[model samples]
Target chain A: MVLDLLASGLIYSSIIVLGSIGLSLVYSIANFANFAHGDTMTVGAYAALVTFGAVGGLGGTVLGLPYGFFVALGVGIGMAALVAVVTEKFIYEGMDVGSIGLLITSIGIAFIYRAIIQMGFGADFTRYDIPAMRPIDALVTYGIRVTLQDVAIVASATVLVVGLHLLLQYTDLGRKMRAMADNPDLARVSGIRTDRVKLWTWIIGAGLAGAGGVFLGLFSRLTPRMGFDLLLIIFAAVILGGIGSVYGAMLGGVLIGMTTQLTPILSELGAVLPLVPDTWGIPIGIEYANAIAFVIMVAVLLVRPSGIAGEVV
Target chain B: MSLRAIVDDPNAYWSGLTRAEQGVSGFIAGFVVLLLGGLFTGILAPTYFLFLVGIAGMYSLLSLGLNVQWGYTGLINFSVAAFFGIGAYGTALASASSSPVAGNLAPAVGLFVALVLAAILALLIGIPTLRLRADYLAIASIGLAEVVRIVILNEDQLTNGSAGVRGIPTFFDGWPLLDTFPQTMPSVAVSWLPSGTVVLGQSFWSALLNVVVVVSFIAVSYFVLKRAHRSPWGRVLRTIRSDEDLARALGKNTYRYKMQAFVLGSLIMALAGVFYAHLNLFVSPGDLSPITTFYVWVAVMLGGSGSNRGALFGGFVIVAIREGTRFLNAFEFIPFDVAPLRLLLIGVIIVLLMRFRPEGVLPPQRELIWPSVVDDAPEQPDSGVRDSKAGESND
Candidate 1:
């Protein structure tokens, strides 16, 4: 049972990690919490759904997912990036009310994105056109039930994260982005065009979020509110790992995802493990999982305003 | 100008007003006339109109509550809906006949319990988020609000789950005279109406009573805010909003002040919720959605943050947007649902408002210093910078 939870946790964590990195990057570089980030994920999911519908599964399949699905994923990422950049250019570029203003504006943007998507898609849950796959027979014996689709999701997320890491560390644009995120003024003084880098940040950040959205759809189902629903959990992950630190976001996402998936077994853990009191356990049900994450977030804010990886203030 | 001057020489006051003020006054006057005409012509029912007024008043109460926190102290609270829901559920669970937990309580008792719960919830949320950066509060409050919604949604034993609590009596259920006033009122028919006789019945009287209840709530809140906004306490909050470091340097406990404003504002929001429960006569988890929070936010911003008058105007604007979209449903040419259209309008309005007029339509124009203190110190030079920062975003 625990192994099954672990398997599910891994799949959930990959999606969360993909989301957190983008949110953290935007928070650091854009100098405001983008409330629209979640809705951008929705845009990606819906965009991919449309793409997958348009392009039927090309003959061969990889890890239970059709090749066309990967093509759809790429389009989703691109579309999300394009939409975000366009929004930034048209709406956000002219605003001068500081970061706080931007934050409020992002809420408006979030609603707009969701409303448009809802208008088109209708307020209903939907799934990709892919056929459902059962848990692998081999893994079911070990109590580790997961499908090839889950493996594919995790693998794709790893690849994306690695690619981002390489882009941040090895590339010149990455260095510029890092420098800009650290200090916009210093980056500008050092001859980097802050505007261009900001545009790039939106693209990369929104692109990753888009990928996360697609994976999230595959893992569960898609609704207009799906991304908005997942937003707070992603926030917990980012805050836990320390806001603005990409690596920290990854760490936080994994921990939060594991803890969330493991919540159903919390009462059993006390009885299963050797403890002073056999019955001593948190009696909370799985419904309180999100609430638990939020409580942990508030607790983190109380004890350490600066997250685990952030510089102590 | 003094109230006495306006009362003594109303014509002079009217003539002395700027073109913009005159235009706004004229618009309001015209709109009221149109509304009354609609009521008399049978185009709009009096009961529905009264209900709209009650809802407008509720939004005004919410905006006023928010004005205390975001307007005066610059606290970014995104959990307005949570506090509002707490008030609604708190009262509903206590007073609703169908309540599985607690039933058959007087609404006054429910109001008291709701306020206390709201205050406690405010402190719990405020204690942690208040000490952080401004935006952090926005994030944390919203996240915590989701927790509140989830709890309300999942805790079926307590909140009656998603089905919601029904059979809530009106606020005057136990009150003497007022309790039976709506029931005792005779139906009235206006014979002079062009569209024939318009009847006002028990429901109309009930709605009128609700409007009266909400008006009292608004009036009491307005009076208290007017006094508080001009007091030394309000000055300190304004200072904190503009420059917290400066307020701290002057030996003010910024956190305490923020928490006080947060709790007070949350209490007002809860008050709105309490009113909503009795008015709507049902409470559901859906009432706790974040959209309600944002709607109040749009009201505050559009009406002019920190200005009570602005809050009132913003409240009316909200009703217009909300009801106007519903009216859009009457037109069959529109293919999409009005719900998404309303969302789109709200989003567009927020974005545009921030982009073009971040100070809002009716930003607080007066200096925030206590009238008594400033009146006695007339020799002090008015700093333009400080005045400009009155209701605009300081950050």
Candidate 2:
């Protein structure tokens, strides 16, 4: 049972981390919490759902193509890019005038976007209606079953993370991002067009955010407030990992995901030896699971306000 | 008329006024503006206008309370919803102690008590958290608000969990006290009107009673804020907002000031919640949500910063726009489904105002200056000659 929950946590972590990475990136370089990020993830998941419905019939033994996954990615990435571009052009352009103003603007955009989505999607749940998720052997070996979707999610996330590492470390554009983040004014004065760098920042940030959104849909049923569910925790992760550090965001996401489920896991911690309520519960308590990320965020801030990864921004 | 008098000397306008003077000024100004706004609404229907006026007054109270903290002290209080919920739950618990049956419920002395208690809750949360800078505070407060909701949701014994505590009572013509208040204020016969008695409130005047109670509370808040802001204490608070380190170095005890700001701001928020609960006569956990904070934020932000008048003005604008949406919806020019857009508009205003006119629609004059070069400059210094040539990537 413990292993099952742990495996589930890992899968949860992957989906959340993807979404969180964008939030972390946006906060670090853009210099404000992009409150709309949760909606962006929701939109991405919606895009994936649309794609599945539109293209799942393309192939198999009798039905053969199997191209829906790629379709989902395209839709997700495209939706994210749209939000990124529109947000930059319409919302964020004038925001640098004030951080608090920008934050509020993001909130507005989030509400607007979420409302639009609700109008279209009808504030109900959406899913693939696919077969049961098959747990992988690795997850099973850990005494917890990993579903097929989980394996697929982990594999893609790993590749994406690796790809992100290469993009940040090896690419010239990546280096420029690093430069811009380090000091936007300096980078602009030194010859790198900071505007162009920031533009790429949006593209990359939104793209990753979209990618994470797809993972979220795969792990659980999509609902109107799915993004909201993860929003605070993602914010906590971004802050925990150190704002702007993709790696920190990922670390924070995973840590947070684990802790959220950990309380319930602890509730069953070996009968008489259970630490909480005869059930191995969270280090804090139950019901607080929803609030776990926030507590961590506050604690981390008191100790290291700059965040765990030491802020690359 | 008086606003015109103050407008001429806008810079020295608010702070220089004495507390009694400020209180009277604020009250008269508030009554006039609200009366005017409501009169317009009332032209269509008096009942509707009174409702609009009362709601606007309550919302203004909430926003003004927010203004004191965020506007005056530069504290980002995302947990206004939490305090609001706390007060509401306090009211609910107090009134419903007897049972779920509505009329049988006990009187709500606790509602009045909860306003102050809620402030203590705010202080408890704010003391440890407000020490951080803006971004951290934003994150922290969001978390605190969530904690509040979750606590309300889980504390089934107290809050009744998500099912929510319901059937709370209002401060009323209905309360038994109505019978007693008339006895105290009394009807008096004047020499000029020997045939009739000039009375404060008729025996059955619950509306009059509610108005009196609300007005008194508003006056107290106005007085306390006016006194504090004009005092040596107020100067210290404003100074801390501009530069905390400087305030600390000057021995102002910045922590206490922030605590005071948080506590006071939260107390006002709670008071507003209490009034709001009574005005609505129902208390449920849903009454408080994060959106509540942002709404108050809209009020405070749209209202000018560090200026109570601005805060009040901002509150008026937010409530007007929100309530006005319904009027516009009646015109059918815009779909009423666009009710959600009201929030979107607030967000737009928040973003745009922060970017272009952060002082709000009625911000202080000095805030209209060019965006500070020093304010958002790169963290590290750019060696002079280097800035002229071109931009370099920092990493």
Candidate 3:
């Protein structure tokens, strides 16, 4: 049972990390939390779902692999990239003239983005069928009975995280981005081609957000409002871990994932208690179980403001 | 860099405000915002006047409370809704338990008790949460707000949770009547304009009565806070807003000052809740959502930070726009089926306004009246300068 929960928890962590890395990146470089990051994820997920429905599932496999997943990933990435550009130009660029100013502007722009999504796409939930996500459960017993899509989420998350780590730490572009993040003025003074780095930062950041959105869609289902809900959780993770630290965000995500996933399952034990679950729901209230992890974020921030890893000055 | 270059830029937007025409335009625009509000009420239902004006008044009270924290103290309070809700509940229960006749433990006493309790609650929450810098405080306060709402909702005994409280007394007694004549439908008001129509199961006159009470409360609050915001105490607050460290260095106990501002602001908000309870005559957990907090923020931002009148003005305008647009379904262009579009429109308008115009339509300038300035005496160096005149005191 422990292994089962952990396995499922790992899948959620992957999704969390994917969405949160962009947030972490934006905070590290942009110096303000992008409250709207989750909305972009929503925007990307919808864009891909709408696009996939238009195409004939990207046709057959290339070299015997399903091309449909890539089609989804490509569409997700493409949409994320487009969204990042538009938001940066219209929303973040002008208002975020100062770092902290960006924070407030992002909140407003988030409302706008959410509004547009609310207006155009409407406020209903949706889902798309991923054909390749089947038959994985047969391979493993005591696997806590996760779905095929759950396994895909885990695999995709691992690839994305590892890929992002490599891309951020080892690549030349990554170094330039980091340099710019460290001191935007100095980066520009040093002729590091800061604009190129910023553009890519948003591209990668939003792409990850998109990937997170896709995984989230897989994890549960799609709704116009899925991003706004997820945004708060993801923000808690980034802030709880440390601003701008990818590894911290991943760790934070896993931790939050476990807390939310495992806590309620443990709440059944509250039922087992002599008088607790039936009378009080004590130790944990299962009805508002969703509010549990966010409370933890607040508690963590109150106790430790710089987060788990202190933010760089 | 020289302080001269930093402090007074010849071509600064603020400098342009020192020009007489701009100042006249500012006052005109301010009046225009109010006129627009009256126009909004006229176009919709006149009964909507109560809702619009009441909401603006309500938002003003909340923003006033926020301004005390953010505008004066440079504190980031993301949980304005929670405090406002507290005020609402606090007042509702107080009024529910009030008796009109007894001078001591009577209706006025109930109000006093609610106001005091609300202040205490603000301190209780603010002490723990406000210790952090702006970002963490923002997060923690937001968290605290959520926690409180969830708890109130969960505690169905004290609060009705999502169902909310009802039948709280308006407490409009004891104050002398402003409209000395017996109330009646106006002799010449537009027809089909809800001027004398039944609304929300309430007679237009009764709703108008509620609006009058709420507006009066707001007006009184505006005067009191406006005075306090300009006083020596208010000066210290402005100092804290501009530079907490500087304020602390200058023999000011910043923490106590912060606590005082927070509590006072919260008290005003609690009163707003009291107003809200009477206005809606019904309260629900729905009214205490995070959205409410942001709406207040939008009001303060849209009006002008630091200026109590501006914040109050913002409160009314934002609420009117929101409520008015939602009520626009009365016209054929919008069917009732698409009324869900209200949230989307509000979100878009707020975003566009904030993004394109962060200073808001009526950005806070100096208190135009000398009396408004006299009490607020620390003498802000060129209040018209840009870059957060309220939040960044460097002296």
Candidate 1 chain A weakest lDDT stretch, 10 residues: A268-277
Query: What is candidate 1's lDDT per residue for A1-313, written digit by digit as tens?
Result: 9889989999999999999999999999988899999999999999999999999898899999999999999999999999999999998888899999999999999999999999999998999999999999999999998999999999999999999999999999999999997889999999999999999999999999999999999999999999989988999998998888889899989999988998988877676578547777778889998888988887787788678887676
Q: Between prediction 2 and prediction 3, which has the larger lDDT?
A: 2
Q: Give a tens-digit lDDT track for model 1, residues B1-395.
A: 56997999999999976664676688679878988988878888889999999999999999999999999999999999999999999999999999989987999999998999999999888887899888878888998999999999998989899999999999999999999998899999877888898788899999999999999999999999998888888999999999999999999999999998999999999999999999999999999999999999999998777888889888988998898899888899888766798999999999999999898887787555555674467564676436445578756
Model 1 regions lying over 4 Å from their true place: A276-278, B1-23, B369-395
Alpha-carbon deviation at B269 in model 2, angstroms: 0.2
Ranking by lDDT: 1, 2, 3
Candidate rank order under DockQ: 1, 2, 3
Docking class of 1: medium
lDDT of candidate 3 over B1-395, digit per residue (tens): 24485477745645545453366456658856865665545554556655666676777778877777776667778877877777667666655533222222233555676687687778778888766767667766777777778877887667756666665655553345523222434433444443343233334566667677677777787788878877888889888877888988999998888888888778877787777876775667777788888777777776666767567766766665676566576678552335446555556656676567666656656643455355456656566567555778867
Deviation (Å) of B175 in candidate 3: 11
Q: Distance (Å) between predicted and true CA of B163, model 1? A: 2.4
